[model samples]
Target: MTAGIGHPMETQGSGAPGAGGGAIGLDELDLSIVHALQIQPRAPWTLVGSVLEIDPVTAARRWARLRDVGAAWVDGYLSPAQEDMTWAQLEIAVNGARLMDVVRTLCDDAGVLSLKQTSGSRDLVALVQARDVDTLAEYVSERVCRVPGVQGARVHVITATPFEGSQWRLRSLDAGQRERLRQFDETRPAPGTPVTAEPLRPVERRIAVALGTDGRMPLAALAREVDASVATTRRALGRLLNSGRLALRCNLARPLTGWPVSAMYFASVPAEHLDATATALRTLPELRFCTMTAGPHNLFLDVWLRTLHDVHALEAHISRELGHLRLRVEERAVILRTFKHVGRVLDRHGHSVRSVPINTWK
Candidate 1:
């Protein structure tokens, strides 16, 4: 959902990411600033500074420094507005030689939220979103399946996302600061809650898209970007933010993070144990996104571990403690590289370079 985030500066400078393509080495303050924005991406400098015990100017400057290096970024993408919207995980088999070409073509498409090359049975894995079942079916049949080098695609519709990335944060923030900075809690909607499906207003659409790349853009700058009065823009923004139709998150480059390795687990939990199994997983700090999918494997887990050895340890830990859940780890894959994630294009080292706006409405 979201990663390390920073507030936008009054001015931005262009440059290559952190030196020599090595570890970002985010220090205490840097991590704290990221945690502040992660908790609330659009938090003002004054609020962040007060809570983090730093000057407003310092907070803004630090955020700019991190952003310039592509160490951290804010991202905004689709939120499930209604029940009809479908989320799918695509395990794609590609012809090896045409890998880059397939990635180039699919990255530009709005529905492909995230696509990455992996080390396993599938050449690629893509997280796709669409308006409805028919829309998703059409996209797969006409667009994805027909792609030149696509050997095959197995689609797993995400039935229930018990946990997601937005709810995560660095342990850098202390209890008091964490408690005080709770403006927006990115909690998942309770089951059976009525979701709104109201259409986005013209100005709202423009504003939402503009924030995808820079979620922490200043209100004044944001107003100018959308070409509307500050008052009009603010009103629209307030509605959109409180509306629960928009998903805004900040992302950090995983390679620079201590937990650099990314892995996926395909597991199945019997109907009776699904809820308890998901609840048990919430205790795992390494778990990123855990979803219930309609496939042979009912649950899919995306995790970040410090090293490859940790993978086996994690699985063993699950098996030892949660044997009663009847969860079976069916298939596993190590993500070699992620070319594009949630619309942001990343460098080889995983630093975000640019973004292709999500075009879900169309």
Candidate 2:
């Protein structure tokens, strides 16, 4: 499975590394550790060390350091089952003085899954989830707009999530390492199957809470957190995995990976060619996030690149290839800072610093 937002493998570093002087630095070994975990997020340190030709204790210590400084992390969240769930992307215009207050209020709401401060006409962007269309309308129209200082709000209902944060990878691992790591990876269910919403049991909720902060938590430790036998916890986890109710993401520090710039594009595409267009865009490695939304601009894309110059090249490529689909660029927004991704809160440098579990049913 791909790493989710903020659920990246820990990279050993002192501080933000790529900025040079004053930023923490990462060596090749640190990168190797990260690549290994990206391939197999829950691999034991001993096994990971063996693959990297290091001692287990050394690997553990390196991870601890990375985790302590918010350099790397792993997180878990419930995936969208085949249920009647509504996912909406919101663009909120807020007063400058009350921006922080508005952000805090939205962040506390369980419906808001991800929040980002961006450079564009909108002051903030939020990804929210609700049970159905009416509930989503209530949250966005009544609740979000009612927040103090929220001057305006635009809601984009996500009709199809062609790609998500979890599918994006660092592509740092070699074929051999990735092949070896796959042996320990868990199996995910095939996509497109109709899934009904099943309320999580109390024990399951506790387990999800524990895993949200650390996807690699030992099964024994997870059992203790939920106050259940290891066997029982493992069985429940297996059920959750088989049902595609829970997802574990292995994410990384993008700055260290030489891809620092992130840009989001909103475009309008012809309805007849929407599926074909989304299918083609999915193959591009640069795309980290893509979704089909119902709004003035129906197609949304988030891409990461090595440099700012690459954005132009990407735009040109899109125009040249999908131009026949009549995809019109509406707006482009550069992510200024990400406060929360998935269920984890990030620092200015895009490090996973903390967790606030998402309640999809809430």
- Backbone collisions counted per model: 4, 4
- Please write out the lDDT profile of model 1 over residues 258-303, one tens digit for every residue: 6777889889989889989888887777887888889889998998
Q: Pick the candidate with the highest TM-score.
A: 1
Clashing pairs in 1: 3-250, 3-251, 4-251, 4-252
The alpha-carbon lDDT assigned to residue 181 of candidate 2 equals 74
Scored by lDDT, model 2 comes in at: 0.75
lDDT of 1 at 54: 86
Which pairs clash in model 2? 3-250, 4-249, 7-251, 8-251
Query: How do all models score by TM-score?
Result: 0.87, 0.85
Worst 10 residues of 1 by lDDT: 2-11
Cα miss at 116, model 2 (Å)?
Answer: 1.3
